[model samples]
Target: MMNKGIDREIDWRLRVFESLSYPTIILLPDRTIIAVNGRYLEKMGVEEEEIIGRSCREVNLRNYPEQKFPCAEQGECPLARAVHTRSGQSVLLKYHDVYGGEGWEERVFSPILGADGEVDFIIESIRDVTRVKNLEKMYSGVRELIDQVVQTSVSGIIAADRQGRIILMNRAAEELFGYSGYDIDNVNIEDYYPPGVAREIMRKLRSEEIGEKGKLPITRVTIRRKDGAEVPAEMTAVIIYEDGREAATAGIFNDLRDKLEVERQLKEAHAQLIQSEKLASLGRLAAGVAHEINNPLTGILLYASMMREKLEKDHPLEQNLRYIIEDTQRCQEIVKNLLAYSRQSNPTRQYFQLNEALGESLRLVRDQKLFLHVKVVEDAPAAPVLVNADKNQLCQVVINLIINAVDAMDGNGTLTLRTYEDRPNRKAILEVSDTGGGIPAENMSKIFDPFFSTKEVGKGTGLGLSMAYGIMEENHGRIYVKDTSPEGTTFALELPLVPMSDVILFDSIG
Candidate 1:
């Protein structure tokens, strides 16, 4: 009865061991397989009798001939290690199946100690880990490729976790923000944005009304740099998802400083073209009107002079005749000015010193009633600043600018005439500044337009600035408002400088 009870207890233990899911086996210290569960026999496709009393190496060889030796000869085998150390040991190994297919498995050996505190039997459990290892390798390769793409992109890329902590910042982002030695890890994404901007962006990215499918449209924003300078950027952002849940947010930014500058220059050029076209149209109209009025004014002047001669000395009508003659002469002068504005006579181009031309213009206007009380200051360079332009046309431009400056000051403030050379550009610059209330903003754009004048009627014909603008253009020069404020206004004239070699050659020829 004692032997029967002992046998039943051993049978109950074997039944419990066979019910386990994993492929499990029991081995003696000699490395002989003493017992295996149904799971092991099913997995190996072999009957229990074929492996029960066989050595572990012999059993492995029957199933996987490619594996020459089992745990005993294999270096650091889990079963051998378990027995030697009298503890649990685990290792990964490669094995082949009955159909000549290979895969990986993790084998764990737990040594069961006897009363002598020595390993008596070893229990081994095998788990397939081939799919898990392959997944890890694929994930590593994909991560490396993604890193390469982000690092090489021209547009800056920034990625942050759902909690707004920065996770990745590409090299472009570092350069855009002027951060070369700054640490970025765990830094909040809001720190890179201006006040309240990051939160607003995230809100737009999350709202379907503002964005589409977790993506925000490209928009302009001012981003503060590491040095506290604000830079304009065009940005597009999207929310990243992993396993159907929100994972992170990523933004792509393009610096717009260069692009915006290019756009501004194009706009300025377009405005200049439009102004030129308008001036050309008005010039044709002025020419026609001046020719029609010139003959009548000449007839009137001749008749008024004859009538003045016909009047007796000290006669009441003599003074009236002189007044009529003087008024007709003034009208004739106006017609001549109109013809000049219409470009009836082409410019006779010549090289001349800009300061001399300016001086001539100032002398012509110095005795005028409008300039009698005004202070005139000249700030020309000591050396000659020569320009290859028509001297008479330049004189007209300088005279018109000076008279306008005097009128702007209402005959009380200062008029400054300055000449300088832009050596790098091979050009000469003439600036006429006035200490007057600057041009009103509403009139600034129309100041050069024909018939657009700020002066009271009869005080101006509104053609002075328009004529000056045309003369500068005809000479291949530029005229623009250099600076203007409530305090004053400065008009600049840029003309091409005559080279010293050309001047010397012309002098020798002369």
Candidate 2:
């Protein structure tokens, strides 16, 4: 009965060995295959009679020559290694099975110790791991593709960790920020935004008012550049999550300098079209007025000259006669201005204090009827802001801007004139701001156009800004809308600066 139980147990062990999915072989210490499972016999397409008692190394070399590692070329395999180390060993190999299928295989060799702790036998098992290996390769390729796409994108992409530390920045971001890889190492992400901007962005990102929570949609914002300039940009940002918790944040930015410039040009072009139409209609009126006034003005000039010549020197009537001639000439000048709505007059260039010209412009209209209810505030530094430009034309531009500001306010508002010295760019900026309703969006495009005006027929000629634009261009200067809102509008005029070293020292010589 004991012998019968022993035979039953052996049969059960053989059945379990055959049930393994992986190919299995039992080998002796000398690399000889002593026993083989049914799985191995089936995979090798050979009967157990052929592989049993055969050498494991010889069978692998003859049927599975593609098996690699364990220095098989040197007559050593994982089976031999397992016996020598008294432990398990593994090797990866590519193989062709009996059914003509090809894939990756993990060959493992586990030593079976005897009662004396000596490796008496080894078990060789081959596990097909092609699916796992293929998955890893696919994952690697995907990661590489994502990295390439980010680096080559036109929009600037930046990512940061939960600690607000900058962790990644793409090539476009580097170019936009004017920073290098080594330059921004260990830099905090908050350093890129202006004061309180990062906090506000985070707050909005978490709030549902502006956009979906954890996502800030595309919107305009200001970023602080490496050179200390506040640049306009459009940005979209999102919070990264891991396991339902915030992990990091990423932002995509688009520079708006070029876009804003294109819009401004389009507006200017439209404004010019409207201005031209009005100038054409009103130019005919100016011509008619000049023609009708010239004959009468010439007659008065001739009679006044004769009367002044006949009168004695230092006589009271002589002075009155000279006044008539002078006043007539001033009237003639006024007529010339009427016809000069579209004229481009030459300017005399010289070095002058920009602040002085601004002051002069303010003084010329300080006591005027329109200025009675207007408050003028000058915000220029005490130091002279010198510029090389046409002094008269510069003052004319300032005066025109002031008049526009006053009119925009309907004769009752604060007019602030501010000046700034931009020595780095060698520019002098003068801004005229007024507390009034902002210019209409539709009218903004027509402001610089000929004949464009918001005023009534007789109140304006629609040529003030057109003439101002032409004068600015002639003087190598620029004029632009500095800032505007429902509460106010500011127009800025920029001119080239005259360095102190080049300033004439007439005062010192005298």
| CA lDDT scores, all candidates in order | 0.86, 0.84
lDDT of each residue in 1-510, candidate 2, tens digit only: 999999999999889888888999888889888888888888888887788777876787777676664567675667767878899998888766668776788988889899999998888898889899889889999999999999999999999888898888999998887776787675778789898999999999888998689999998999988887888999999999999999999999999999999997898777655655666666677768887898899999999999888888988898788889999998787677665553434678887888988989888867779898988888988888888888887888899899999999999999999998998999999999999999988776668765678998877766678767767866888787878899999999999987786776744665
lDDT of 2 at 453: 89
Candidate 1: stretches off by over 4 Å = 1-127, 137-145, 185-188, 203-215, 239-248, 306-315, 351-387, 409-429, 433-435, 496-510
lDDT of 1 by residue, 1-510 (tens): 999999999999988998988999999988889899999988888888888888887777667666534454555566777888888988777776667776788878889999999888999888888888788778999999999999999999998898887788899999998654356763578878899999999888888986597899999998988788989999999999899789999999999999999998898798789989998887798889999998998898888888878878888998888888888888888888888888888888888899988988887877867776888888988889988888889888988888788777877898889999999999999999999899888888888888788889998989888888899998999888988888888999999988778899999999
